[model samples]
Target: MCRLFAITSELPCSPMTAITALDVMKEGHDGSGVGLFMTDLAGPWEEFKGAPILSGIFTNKGLKQLDHYMMELGFTTKYKLSIKLPKAPPPGVPKRDVYLIRAYDYPESWEGLSQEEVNHRLMMIRLQLRQMGLDTGDMVVFSFWPDVIMIKEIGDPMTVAEYLGLDRKELRARVIMAQGRQNTNYAINLYACHPFFIQGIATMTNGENTAFVPIREFLESRGFPGYIGYQSDSEVFTHILHYMYYKLGFGIEMYKHLITPLQDRDLECHPNGSFLRHIKHTCRRLTIDGPNCVIGVLPDKTMFMVQDRKKLRPGVVGGKPGMWAFSSEICGLDAAIPDRDKSKDFQPMYLDTAVVGSDRKEVKIWRQTEPLPLQL
Candidate 1:
C-alpha cells in the first residue's frame, strides 16, 4: 500500500505540510518514491494562471531541445522557477541535470483557439514531448497545464522534498496532493508515481486495482490520447474520472457510482434508479475491484475521496473551515491539521464520497443511497 495525503486551503501553503503528514504514516509505505501535484499556485506563479506551465526533469541536452522545439512552435517563455541545488544531493537521491517548472505563452497561431482546442493542443504537446524523451531517455514530463505543477522522484518523501528545495516560498500552492509510494506492484519507474495528472484532473490511490486490465482496455479503446500511459495500474483511476466527468459530461457524484456501483437491491430504491442502472450496464467494464481508496481533484478545484465497494482501505477527512485534509490514516490527518475538531473528522463508508468544493469551507458526504441535490 501507499500513503496518500492531500490538503486544500483558502490560503496557499507549502507542500511540506503534506510531506510531513506522509512521514507520520511512514510505516504504510516503503519510501521507494514520492509524487506531488499542486494547483491554485501562489507566489510568483499566482499572477500567470493563464499560461501553461511545464513541470518535469530534463537532461542538459533535453532542455536545449525543449527550448528549440518550443521556439520553433512560436511559444515564448513567460516565467520560470529557478532551482538551485546544494553542491551534493542528499544521500540516496540520484543527481539530475535540471528540474524545470516553466510557464509559456501560447503559440501566436493559437490566438483564436477555443479553450477546449487549447487544452487538446497542450495535451498533444505533452505527449509528443514525453515520446521524444522516451526515445532519448533525457526527459520526464509530468504535466503541461495552467496553474498546476507536478514533481516525482525515487526516494523518501521528506528527503526528496529537501533535495528539490520544495520549501522555497515560490513553490507554494492552495491545493496540494502528495503520495509516498510503496512500490509493491511495479518496478520503481518515475512515470509510475501517483498523484497522476491529465488535463485539469489529478488523483492518487492507496491500494491495488484488481480489475486493472479490463479498465485499461476500456479506456484505451475510447481513443483518447491522454489515456494512453498505464505505467501504473492506478493511472486508470484518473482516466476513468476524466472520461466520466469530462467526456461523458456526468456530474462528479456519478464517478462514485460508476467505479463502485451499488447492488441491484440497493439501487432499486435510489431516486435515479433507472438512469443509474443504464449507466451500470453500459459502463460495466469500468467497474473497479480490490482494496482501494481514491483522492482526486477536479477541473473546478473540487477535491473528493471515495472508497471501494467493500471499504477495504482506510481514509479520513478532517480540519477546520478554510483548511482540510484527506489522508489514508487519521494519524496522518492529525499531523496535517491538529487544531480542527476531531469529532467532525469523517471516514466515508462503502457508499459514501467526501467532497470539498473550491471554497474549501466544508466537506459534503454524498452517500450513494441518498438522492443528490438538483445542482450537485
Candidate 2:
C-alpha cells in the first residue's frame, strides 16, 4: 500500500506541510519513490500565472536539443529556474543531470486559437517531449502547464525533499499533492510515480487498481492520442477523470457514480435512478473494483476524495480557516493541519464523493444515491 496526501487552500501554502504529513504516514509506504504535484503556484512562480511553465530534468546534450526544438517551434523562454543538487551522488541514487522549471511563450501560430485549443497543443508538446525523453535517455519532461509543476524522483520522501532543497527554496502553491509510492505493481520507474497529470486533471491513488485493464482498454479505444501511456495502473485514475469531465462533459459528482456505480437494488432508492442505470450500463468498463481511495484536483482547482464501494482504504477529510486536506490517514492530516477541527472531520465511506470547491471554502458530500442537479 502507498500513502496519499493532498491539500488545497485559498491562501498561498508550502509543500512542506504535505511532506510533513507524508512523513507521519511513513510506515504505510516504503518510499521506493515520491511524486509531488503543485498548482495555483505561489512565491516566485506566482508572477508567471498566465504563461506556460515547463518542468523536467535534463542532461547537457538533451538540454541543447530541447532549446533548439523549442526555438524551432517558435517558443521562447521567458524565465527559467534550475536547482543544482550536491555533486556527490547518494550511494544508490542514479546521477541526475539538471532539474529545471521554465516559463515559455506559446508558439506564434497558437496566438489566435481558442484557450482550449492552446491547452491541447501544450499537452501534445508534453507528450512529444515524453517520447523524446524515452528515446534520448537524457531528458524527462514531467509537466507543461500554466501554474503547475511536478517533481518526482526515487528515494524516501524526506530525503528527496532535502535533495531538492524544498524547504530552502521558495516553492509554494495553493494546492499540493504528494505520494510516497511503495512499489507494489511494477518496477520503480520515475514516470510510474503517483500524482499523474494529463490535460489539466491530476490524481494519485493509495491502493491497487484491480479494474485497470478494462479501464485502459475502454479509454484507449476512444482514440485520444494522450491516452497512450499507462506506466502505472493508478494513471488510469486521472484518465478516467479526464474522460468523464473532458470527453463526456459530466459534472464531478457523476465521476463518483461512473467509478463506483450503485447496484440496481441500491439505485432504485434514488430519484435519478434511470439516468444513473444507463450510465452504469454504458460505462461499465470504467468502473473500478477492490480497495482504493483516490485524491484528485480538476482543472478548475476543485479538489476531491473518494473511496471504493468496499471502503478498503483509510481516508479522512478535514478543513479549517483557509484550507482543506485529504489523506489516507488522520495522522497525516493532523501532521499537516494540527489546528483543523477534528470533530468536524469526515471520513468518506463506500461510494462517497468528498468534493471541495476550488476556493477551499465550500465542501459537499455527494453520495451515489443522491440525485445530481441538472444545472450542476
Candidate 3:
C-alpha cells in the first residue's frame, strides 16, 4: 500500500524542455567507456542549467514526508512521495541490498538498455504511478535504507535466571530464560536511501556520478524491482514543471510559493540519507597488507591500490616516478616531481607539494603540477 498512496504537489514554472543526453557530453566524452568525476558532474550541472531542483535519494518510511517536501518545493520526480519508507538494515552494519526493476528502452541496445532509456523509464514510472495513486520512488527508500532497530543484551544469567537456583534435573528442564539482565546496548542502522536511476547513456568517461543502478546490475536478472530499481528525478521534474505551466496554468509567483515549502523541508531534513563520508573515511583508514596496499575504514570494505613501491615490472609506482604522480605520502595523486632531468633517477625533488591534470577519460593522469605554498 505504501507504493500506492504517495502524491506530489509540484507545479512546473516552465515548459517541457527537450534534450538529448549526447548533447551534454563533454568533449572527448564521445562514448569513451571510462569514468566521470566531480568535474564530470559539471556536465549534469550544465544540463540542469539553473533549474532549481529538489532532489533526494533515501529509503522508505520517509517517502511520504519527502514526497510532500519535494512537491511543496516546486519540483517533481519518481518517488512514492506519500508513503512511509521501510527499514533497510540495522545500525553499524553494512548491507548492500538489491532491487529489481523494468525501465524504458531506446531503439538501440548498448549491451542492454541505454542509460537514457533507463532514466526515461524511471520518469515514466512516477507519472504512471501518480495516476494509480502510488509512488515507486518515495517508497524505494525502503529498499536501501531500512529502519534502525535498537537491541539490548542480557548478562549475569545466574543472577537473573531461576535455573541457577534449581537442582541439576530441574536446571536441565528448560533453563527458563537465564541471563535476563541488561548487559549491553545494541542498535541497528536499518535504513535505505531512495534509489533513483537517472538513466542516461554512458556519457561521461571522467568516471564520476555513478548513482545506485549504474554500477550494479543486480536485482534485475528478470526485471528491476521498484524497491531495488531507480528513476531519474531530472526527467520527473521536467514533467512536473511542464504540467504546472500548461496543465494547471501556474505562474512564476505561484511556483515560487510552492518552492518555499520544499526549501523549508530540505533545511530540516536534507543530507539525512548519505553514507559517502562514512565510506570515504573507512577507506582512508586502510593500511598496506603485504604486496597489496589496501586502505579502507570499514572493517569489511577493503580496496587494493598500486603494489609495492619496490616492485618494478610494469606501470608507475611511488618511488619510481618515470611518469607517475607522487606526494610524500602513498597514493598521493599530486606528488611533486622535479624538472625533467633524466639524471635524477626519476626521484621526485624533495618539495612540499604538487598538482597534476589528465585528459584520459578512463584513467585521469595529471599532465602538469604546481607546488603548494611552503609554510615556514
Candidate 4:
C-alpha cells in the first residue's frame, strides 16, 4: 500500500477540448485505453512493486530502463493488475482473418500519381483482400487509408440485387459499385484517449472504439475547421500521440505495469500485440499510427475528456492533478441517477468555482458547458 501525497497545486480545472496546429488523422485506428492502469508514472516503481498480490509476463529483472508517464489523479491502494509485465501482451486470432496488402510507398506528396494509378490502387486493394485470408469477419486497417476498413463481405450483393428486384447481373454491378472497393478498403480512423470498458465493440460505439476520439472532437470543433486529416493508419496514430500523448502517455505505461497481475497467461490463446496499450504504443512507435511526430498524441499540455456513452460528460482525459481519467470500475452516471421517489430530490454538487488560483483570482466555469471565450 502507498501513502497519499498532496497534489502540487489545486487540481487544475478539467480540460474540455483539444486541437493542435498539426492535424493528423495519422494515428493507428487503435488509440489509448481508458483510465490509469499502473500506480505511478513518476517517483519509484518500488512503491508499487509488492503492494499485496500481482503477477506479470515479466518478473521485473530490472534490466530495462523506465520512461516517464502520466494518468488521472485517482488513487488505488490495493489493486489487481488484469495484465502486466513484458511490454506486449499475448495475441489472439482475429475474429476472422486479416492481411497486410502491398505496401503503399507514395512520395511525401502523391503529386506524381495520375488519377488512373489511383483507380488501379483501389482495385488492387480489392483483389488483395480476395487473395488474403480476409473474409467477412476479417479486418484490415490501412496504413494510408486507415479509417476505411474491410469487414468481411460487408453488405449483401444478393440483398442489393433483391432489394432492387432488377436483373441479377446488372443489380450486382450497381451494388458492387455503390459499396465500392475504396469504401471497403478503408475506414474513418477514430481514436479516443479513454476507451470505454465495454464487453465488445458493436455497430454503435463511442470513444471506446479507439483512443483518439476526444481530440478528434476538438479538431472538428468550431475553434478549428478542417484541422484534422488522415490517410493511413500510421499517420492517424502518430498524429494522436503528437497531439495527446507526449508526456501523459508514458504515465499510462505505469498504469500498464500495475495491472500486470490480472492478465491471461495462456501463451496460445493470447499472444503479443493483443494487449491494448502495447497495440496502441506499437502502432504509434512503428508509424503504424503515423509517419512521424506529425501523427501522435497531444502532449500533457493539451487537455481533453471522452464522455462515456451513458454519462454524457465523460470523455478523453490527460494531465497531472485532476489529470484525465476514465473508469469502468466505478459508474458515476449510474450513481448520478436521482432517487426521486425518496423523501427529497437529490442533486450533484456544483461549485461555481472549484478553486481560486494564485493572487486570489476568481476562476469561473460551467459543468455542463465550456468556459467563455478569452479576449485577445
lDDT of 2 by residue, 236-331 (tens): 989999999988898788888889888899888888888889999999999998688999999899999999988888999997857999998999
Please list the C-alpha lDDT of all candidates, in the order they appear.
0.92, 0.87, 0.21, 0.21
Candidate 4 residue 138 C-alpha distance from true site, Å: 6.4
Expressed as tens digits, the lDDT of each residue in 255-284 for candidate 1 is: 888898889998899898888888899899
lDDT of 3 by residue, 1-376 (tens): 0000000001110000000111122121221111000111121223332222222233444445554644553344422212122344233222222221111112233237664454444445443433223344333221111011011111121211111121222111100000011111142111111111122111000111122232133223324333222232111222222333344454222221221112233323424212223322332221111211111000011100122222221112122222322211221221222332323222222111111112211212211022112221
Candidate 3: residue 169 Cα off by (Å): 67
What TM-score against the true fold does each predicted structure earn?
0.98, 0.97, 0.20, 0.21
lDDT: the better of candidates 1 and 2: 1
lDDT of 4 by residue, 7-46 (tens): 1112221111010000011121221111111111112222
Clashes of each: 0, 0, 74, 85
Q: Which stretches of candidate 3 lie over 4 Å from their true place?
A: 1-39, 42-46, 49-57, 77-354, 358-376
RMSD for each of the candidates: 1.3, 1.4, 25.1, 24.1
Can you give the lDDT of residue 90 in candidate 4? Answer: 23
On TM-score, who's better, 1 or 3? Answer: 1
